[model samples]
Target: MKKFQPQPGFVVQAYKFALDPNAGQGAALRSHCGAARTAYNWAVGWVTASWWQRRAEETYGIGADELTQWRPWSLPALRKAFNEAKHTDPRFAGWWAENSKEAYSTGLANAAAAFDNYAKSKNGRRKGRRMGMPRFKSKRKARLACRFTTGVIRIEAAARHVTLPRLGIIRIHEPARGLLDRVQAQAARILSATVRHERGRWFVSFQTEVKREIRRVTRPDTAVGIDLGVKTLAVMADSTGEIREVPNPRHLDSALKLLRLASRTVSRRQGPDRRTGQKASKRWEKANAHRNRVHHRVANLRADALHKLTTAVAAEYGTVVIEDLNVAGMLRNRCLARQIADAGFGEIRRQLTYKTRQNGCRIVTADRWFPSSKTCSGCGAVKAKLPLHVRTYECDACGLVLDRDDNAARNLAALAAAAATGTGVAGDQGTLKRVSKPRGADQKTRATRPRRKAGTGRAGGAILPHQRQTETRDRTQAEALTLW
Candidate 1:
């Protein structure tokens, strides 16, 4: 696949602002969102019916030539079919013209992407989380959203109001001076706008092609190593031997009491019973909204804290090294899951990645199995076992004691040092690659051996030397087993 190369001086960025829509405008926003959801559900049903028809035909022993071809799930095909049936389809015939055409297009685009992702995942061609087949969206559970691409999406000169295609001039809660100044100065162009209702309030986000100015770090040659944990959000050690520890806010843990109280209040109210077709009472709706607001506040607080932390680090350092943490595996620990998640390890790395590139800085990620915490930073000694309960690292070889996270951070900083000196095998000038562990005459651990040195019969992280030496001498005999 060809890589996407953005224009030299331009970058794509999004600006989101909270909206303060009046009652009528709020209702209109909800209506558009509902229309989008309806369109998505209709598309899903249509595709599912087509699949079932094909399956039924095959079961009836229909000839291959006579069987109906499977209906296409592409956006263009779905749009053509929907447009032809809208005038006669009972579900949409009455209200088809009430909303903008962009609403339907958004739903169709999403449906196409969903089907494509499902196919890729089923065929083992997709990465990350596996996706199931496209499912119908529920009105109550579905998030309210709609996007407008070919519309008059602009910020007013006054910097307090904005104009969308159909939804004209909605007031904003915060001043949009940053985006407005760019638009007025011809430094940015708005390409699309998405409006959504989230956490009991309305927000509009503009996707723009912005001309970004190159940024420089305060300390251009300084490299910092960051170690992330539940107790401390980040433990950073710079090239100057300075260590700074940022404490974890533990937002979720702090709010658990209020959350529990609010949840109890919601439970006491009369909620909707889906099986009995009973609607929720007003008290239930009010209680649910209150609970949602609390959750939203917690999210906002966490995001604000993370942004400040990442921005400062990215702006001050030229090179930042962080661990390639297995956050998914870490979350499996029930005892630390909530605290680890609240620390936002994944989010911090994601932000740092973009921020470093946007500025003229670089980021280096250590390999997952590098064993940073188990190694002694003072004397380059590797320990076979280091339990989580041990907060301080005590080196047996050098008798040097230090904080566990601080030792790891210092080890990560050594990687930067190696890369800077041109001694490490860093593939790219800016990207510091993983290096092999140094060989020691007294080393007994097979897990630390380099890939080339570790013999053929390796499984897991260790290799048994005697078992592998016998197999290498009888290579022809081992190959004969494949014939059977």
Candidate 2:
């Protein structure tokens, strides 16, 4: 398949709107998503059947050349096989034609990607954590979603409706005048549309290639460093010696009482029991929905706050510096995990990344191990350690006292200055510095004891190809830094 390349001066973006479908349309949406799931499951089963058959044949002393042929998992292969069997296959024979083919294609695409990832991970070609074989998705657990890459996909002239492939026109909760105007003016072209059921509501997201006008920052000569934390959401210190703080909203903490009440109500109701094949009562469903509403609202509030904060910072500063925080490791601390997660440290950096690009500004990411808080902003003196309990930073060498967050923010701002001037400042090298790997880091821990080799299984007590272990690389190795 050819990769999509947007025209020069244009970028791909998604515009999402809340959908308000009628009851019949809602059922049709569910049916489409279910069709996708069905297709995905069929693909998995067909491909794995050969593996099971080969294993059985080995037990019977059959040669490898005589084993059952393996089924192809590529999209075209799966589509062709599905087309041939749909009329006779008991699982999908009766109602497979009700939903659009794109729904099934979406599922097949997902399954193929899952298999590809697993293969890459197994062969040591993929990064991050190792992936296991793809498993069947449970109907109750799978998210309801479908994508339309072809056929009619458009935002209506009315600005309050959208037309999707096969789904037809559906009303939306909010006006899409911005996207509609862009399309009418030939400034944007819709590439695809995805409908998803999430957080007790339906949403349609249109992927489009948009021609964006580049804009200058509010303060073109200024650089700001943002120090994110649980107590205060952000402490921003600019190169001009001005400091600002944004307080953490703690949305989840504020709504905990209501959430607890909702949870208790759900617990008292007759919920579904998969083991006993029992369905949930109407009251249980209602209570569960109420609990979900609270969670959804909290998520929405967090997203809105982060977007506003990131946009303001991106628009104001020519250069934004933020730390590469170890959020995954921080979550292991049970006492502060909830608070840290609620702060959205990772999300802030992610939003700033693209926002800065769009605003014609740049972003600098400090090394994760950089001692921003331990290094004194004044006199460039480094402290051995700084405990979390000490909110005030008192530099022993320079007699400079300042708020810990403010001091950290100042140090971060110095990094941007160092990069700009091609000189070290406040102990920060112009380029990112490498540090030794610390114990109890976010990555997989090294084994203390000697590890055993893969053991033989059913066939002649020999280790299978899939069972061989792959070597892991050191992720803390030094690398060149580039501005974003």
Candidate 3:
């Protein structure tokens, strides 16, 4: 029942507000976005051309040291190179100064990060999915976004308008009182502002360093576990033996028909053809907008539901336990991908991770391979195997019958105690344990990939210590030894 202590200094936070711009202002915003895209495309082309030149030179039997050096993709190097070329380069010579310099910097910064990630992935130093080389940003496919950091970015005293570097004062669709109040009280300082065009609307997000008050949970001694699924968005079980279920809203499923109709309408209309130089019809644009609106609505609904659920849990419970689901792997199942995506399993855990930390609550993530669903909550007996079709968990040893999700949630709840003690059992499974703590794992260890033998694929790398040992013996031999 330990309480969280207040941090010594401020924390960086973002405040995003929708914008309402005039026709002329919208045109200017689009111009800046285009400028950013142009700069990013130029950088990619320049770096790629340099690479091809070096490769071609090597093909001519040129010495390795004699070949032209490859151009670096770092931001400083890109900026210096662009500065020298802008005056003579026909592409950017005419109206490059129309937009703020920060626009170009934003693009260059993104390019640098992209190349860095690709290099890291090539060396097997980066985690998650591998990143490819940076490509030219297309006007039609790329998201329109620009960031301003060195210029005057501020909110007006009235909280009705915002001022950017070159964009000038633009009216805000929503009130900005929350951010304005903090700034006026000397509790926050704006660091940067990014303008983005999404779903046919413009939004400005301010990154600020703000002083947040330390929050306390309502029930400091209470602990609860969350079991996330498609049918029941979340099944909760608390230490008090009380269970709660939050029904899935199925926002995407509910709007699937509308989305399909809108998509069909768009497909029927005369859309833009870049190859043939054909412009999109007005009707096509309207239909495409309708389709985008449906998608945006679904995303907003899911985010709202997740926020409400996470807020309630973080504010009330002192310790929250949840399973570490392999969402990416789970989504590979074509049959359940749609339903699983609609459930927002990853989003739920993401929101909870931050909310719990902010509200002074602890989050315990059970190992991904933990057999929560295959263990008896009543007596801790581990089942040999449990299939997804088994909705009800019937324990043979303890004679406990309960809902599958509910039993998993209860087991997750018990993990908090096991985690605290480090050596305790969850149900009857003495060997069931967690690998990481609530905060996170060791950064040094987690950041480095495991070493593998030469000629072995990634799958053949070292396995986790908790995994069941494999042998050449048959199932009968393994069972016989267990009985003895």
Candidate 4:
């Protein structure tokens, strides 16, 4: 398949709006999502059947040459086999035609991608964590979503409704004049629409290729470094020596009491039990929905805050410098996980990435081990150790006392300056060289073996073997432990 390449001056974007479908339309939407799930499950079962058959045959001492042929999981293969069997297959025989064909294709496409990922991971061709074989999705746990790439997908002239394949016109909760005007002016072309059921509401996202006009930042020659933390959402230090802090709203923490109360109320009601074949009482469903609403509100608030913060920063600065934080590793700290997650560190970086592009600003990511907080902004001296508990950075060399986050943000800003000047800053000697990992480099750990000689100690004299073999935790581990 050919990869999609947007035309010059055009970028792909998604415009999502909450749907306010009536009862009949809601049911139809559910049907389409159900059709997608059904198709996915069927594909999984059909492909894995041959695997089970081959395994059983081998156990019976059957020769490899006589084993059943393996099933293909490519989209075209799955579609061809599904079409041949849909008429006779009891699973989809009667109601397969109720929803648009795109519903089934979405599932098949997903299954194919899942299988491909599994294959790549197993062969060590994929990055990140390993993947397992595709499994059947449970009706109770699976997300409800369906994508339509064809058949009259459009925003109605009223800008208050959208039309999808087979589902016809459905009302939306908010006006879509932004997207409608663009579409009417031919500045954006809708490529597909995806309907998803989330947070007890239906939403449709239109994927489009939009010709965006990139605007210059307010301060075209300025650079700003952002230091993300739990106490403060972000501490930004600009090249002009202006420092600002965006306070953490702590939305989740503030709503914890309400969430706890709602959860306790839900526990008192008779909830569903799959093993017992008991359905939830209406009171239980209502209580559960209330709890979900609390979560939804928190999520919405966080997203809104992050978007506003990122947009402002991206629009004001010509260059934005952010740390390449190991957020996954940071989450492993039990004490700060909830607070860190609530701060939306990863989400902030993701939004800034695209937002900066649209604002015609450059974003520079500092190396994960850049030691931003440990580096002093006054004399450019890098500290050997700066514990998290020490919120005030006291520079040993220059006697400069400053807030820890403020110092870090200033140090980060210096990195951008160094890049622009093509000269190494005091604390960023090897930063450019270390930005990208060398080919075939092993993943780094937060610990290191002491570099002492087999019988030597810190004084460089002979020492015991046991003492020589003592392991040393890097600054990363020390900081992690301090945070914990």
Per-candidate TM-score against the hidden true structure: 0.85, 0.86, 0.85, 0.86
Tens digits of per-residue lDDT for model 3 on 1-484?
A: 1332334668888999999999999999998888888889888888778677867997999986686655667688899998998888887889999999999998888887777666555546579897777788888789999999998888998999999998999999988999998787778888999999986799999999888876998988989989999889999999989999999999999999999999999999999998999999999999998899899999888888988999999999999998879999999999999999999898888888888877767788887788889999999999998999999999999899999999999998998887678665343322344445544455446558566554332333332222224531222222221221
What CA RMSD would candidate 2 show? 8.8
For candidate 1, write residues 1-484 as lDDT tens digits: 2332346799899999999999988987888888888888888888778567766898999975676655557788889998997899897988879888898888888987887776555445568898887899988799999999987788888899999877789999999999988777677788899999887799999999899987988998889999999889899999889999999888888899999999999999999998999999999999999889889999899999999999999999999999889999999999998888888899999999999888989788877787889999888999999999999999999999999999999998888877778776565534554555654776766776555543332212232221233433222212211111
- Tens-digit lDDT track for model 4 on 1-484? 2344456899889999999999999999999999999999999999889878978998999986787766667788899999998899998989999999999999999998887777555545568898887899999899999999989998888999999999999999999999999887778889999999998899999999999999988898999999999999899999999999999999999999999999999999999998999999999999999999999999999999999999899889998899888899999999999999999999999999889888888788887888899988999899998888999999999999999999999999988887777674322322343535543436644454335454332323332222232443122122221121
lDDT of 4: 0.85
Worst-scoring 10-residue span by lDDT in model 1: 475-484
Q: Point out where model 1 deviates above 4 Å.
A: 1-7, 419-484
RMSD of 1: 11.1
**How far is 143's C-alpha from truth in model 1 (Å)?**
1.2
The CA lDDT at 130 in model 4 is 85
Q: Candidate 2's residue-wise lDDT over 219-324, tens digit each?
A: 9899999999999999999999999999999999999999999999999999999899999999999999889999999999999999999999999999999998
lDDT of 3 at 359: 79
After superposition, candidate 2 runs with Cα above 4 Å error: 1-7, 422-484
Worst 10 residues of 3 by lDDT: 472-481
Q: What's model 2's overall lDDT?
A: 0.84
